[model samples]
Target: MLDFHMVYTCGYWSGSPECGLDDAQQQKLNLVCRNLNLKPGQTVLDILSFAKFAAENAGAKVVGITISKEQAALVRDLCKGLNAEIRFEDYRDTLGEFDHIVSLGMFEHVGPKNYRIYMERISGLLTNGGLFLLHIIGAT
Candidate 1:
């Protein structure tokens, strides 16, 4: 139920209805990178792999993790020759620290039972003053 690109996430229209799906997606990616203030040679952990490509394009060393084997393989293939690493692993098992962490549309799976654990894991993964951006749909 989406465009051919299969990008299932929020889009930044910038008040232009003429914007194509890919254009909107690119806009969102740029916005994320800008807000994170990513720098060259910095480390980034992209949980869910949504912003891996964008972060890589911004010259950051990106480590993207996905539980789905298919997705992991897809990202690896798509990001070939770029400073990006795609891993098929659960976030609970992730290692090392990151200058920035970005997770989109994946927190719904964390559930209330594992919310504390999830937050703790994220906290442990981040470096001092590291930025984390989480985008998820929820009811208030």
Candidate 2:
């Protein structure tokens, strides 16, 4: 199982110092998810989610994917009592016919060479009116 300490330590979980980089990143992610206009009962895809907070907060059905099988299982365990489904798959291969898609701190793992491909893949999964919210960090 993947240790959630790294993810939970981020401000997204709750409290954190203003100087926390993780907090800043999570703030950006939360804003994007909220701006997506997620609705309850909607199918939401969370690619490479570590905490599944956005999906849970939206009160939507979630399909979460992680590259690590064990980590995916952990996510499944965490969401066992909730309306969430967790799986192990490369984000590139995951299927999504969702009303909303949210991903945070994951796109950076995809090299620039694969960024467009990743974007295209996610875009292809949306309904004509679906929204996709991505929180990415660019190198300074």
Candidate 3:
């Protein structure tokens, strides 16, 4: 259903539900990058490969981690020539400090048991005074 940028999660419509899927997905990406205050040459860690918007729109260097090899390959191809790199690996195995971090639709997978550890890892990877945004869809 999400052929537009394969967002996979709900859009950041911001009350613009009249917009089409592609527009909504693009808005979601832009919203995340803007909230993170990403800037040119700055390092950004995206839990999913939503780097296109941050890299192209905000000119930030984005490093994304995904467990699926196929998804990584596709995102890598899509982000070619941009300051975006997609890695096929577990998030816990990731290293390096980033000026900002954005995690979308992945917190739920972290599970309650690993919540503390997950947050700690993300904290360690972020530089002091860095920004972190965690977006999730709640279904009770």
Please tell me which predicted candidate would have the highest TM-score against the true structure: 3
Tens digit of lDDT per residue, candidate 2, span 65-102?
78888878777877867788887887778875988877
- Tell me, by lDDT, which candidate is best: 3
| Residue 55 accuracy (lDDT) in model 3 | 80
The C-alpha stretches of model 2 lying farther than 4 A from their native spots are 1-30
Once superposed on the true structure, which residue ranges of model 3 sit more than 4 Å away at CA?
1-3, 14-17
The true-structure Cα RMSD of candidate 2 reads 4.1
Model 2 lowest lDDT segment of ten: 1-10
lDDT of 1 by residue, 31-133 (tens): 8888989888888998864545554568888898889999888778777888888899999999999999998778888998999999899999999999998
What overall lDDT goes with each candidate model?
0.80, 0.70, 0.84
Off by over 4 Å in 1: 1-7
Best-to-worst TM-score order: 3, 1, 2
Query: What is the number of residue pairs that collide in model 3?
Result: 0
Using lDDT as the yardstick, the better of models 1 and 3 is: 3
Q: Kindly indicate the candidate among 2 and 3 with the higher lDDT.
A: 3
